[model samples]
Target: MSTALNWLSALDHPEFLADRVSAALRQWPDGDAEAVQVAEIDPAIADTSALVAATDITLESSANCLVVRARRSGTETLAAVLVLATTKADINTAIRKTLGARKCSFMSMDAAVEATGMEYGGITPIGLPQDWPLLIDERVVAQDQIVIGSGVRRSKVRMPGPLAQQLPGAQVITDLAVPIA
Candidate 1:
């Protein structure tokens, strides 16, 4: 099976991802070689591995965007991160150090949306408020193309992996740990 979308129109509430696609296109109009397409998925496809498996795509080629909960002082913050499916964030050390917080932990769903202005399972690095901090795992760059959340859970965006690191406030590093089998 391939990742082509034969039913783009069948996507429910496409606006969730449409707005993000529109913004990304306008920003990288001269870049991204592949045409951006929205692949409709069942709402239950929330995990990266599940999305890849459903689309018959390889996990290494999928950019798994994750919402991490972090705490600074008494206030908690949600950090949006993009990494390869084969890895997991080093939350207690790397992420906390990056944020320069005495304490940091993954935020809940409600906290994620309230802080990022994107819905749960829909939050993406692109089009995030300019001030939002994004940490991208370098493993993502090793792939030719990466599939990432298109600001919605119902769909994902297929784009070049390298370009993902260029979004504003995006930092690329190998701070995350490789996922265990």
Candidate 2:
């Protein structure tokens, strides 16, 4: 939070959060919603590498969200996956096998943004379509806290890692991703 960003309680700043994300947060059980925070960032640096290099955020504390499409028997299924920045998602192996798909790949940027109602480079699992099963790597949920997209490129959201598993239909898959190797 140098000259460009100021972290604040996300629940207190609806403007900084995507409409869907804000609504989801408000629905969180108990008062856990207060545990999340947000900080504005230059959209140009919203990509993980640039954001990490520009701020105090560390790779371990950051999470990346990806939209995946798997196809089998001419049927396509879309899902959202989240992993820590230090690890690579095992989309080609674990995910593909899990999906029982003959082929699987990331959804195109345009398709992902359109389906998620989130800005590209700022997709988060929190407000994903209710039909999309969210796959979050176990490592991400084990962390003390994580910094992830707020469904908008203009800001990032921070929350306790365990909260991620509470998102609607989230599946905490062990070995869903491999360590950065």
Best by lDDT: 2
lDDT of 2: 0.90
Mark the regions of model 1 whose C-alpha exceeds 4 Å error after superposition: 1-21, 33-35, 73-78
Shift in Å, residue 22, candidate 1: 2.9
Global CA lDDT computed for model 1: 0.68
The sequence of per-residue lDDT tens digits that candidate 2 reaches over residues 1-181 is 5344588998899798889999888888756889998999989989999998898888899999999999999999999899999999998899998788999999999999999999998899887888888899999999998999999999999989998998887999999999997
TM-score of each: 0.80, 0.95
- Encode model 1's per-residue lDDT on 24-122: one tens digit a residue: 556655535234445667767756766666667677777766677667678765566788777877777887888777786777878767766666776
Q: Where does candidate 1 clash, by residue pair?
A: 69-105, 69-106, 69-107, 71-104
User: How far off is residue 146 in model 2, in Å?
Assistant: 0.4
C-alpha RMSD values across all candidates = 3.7, 1.6
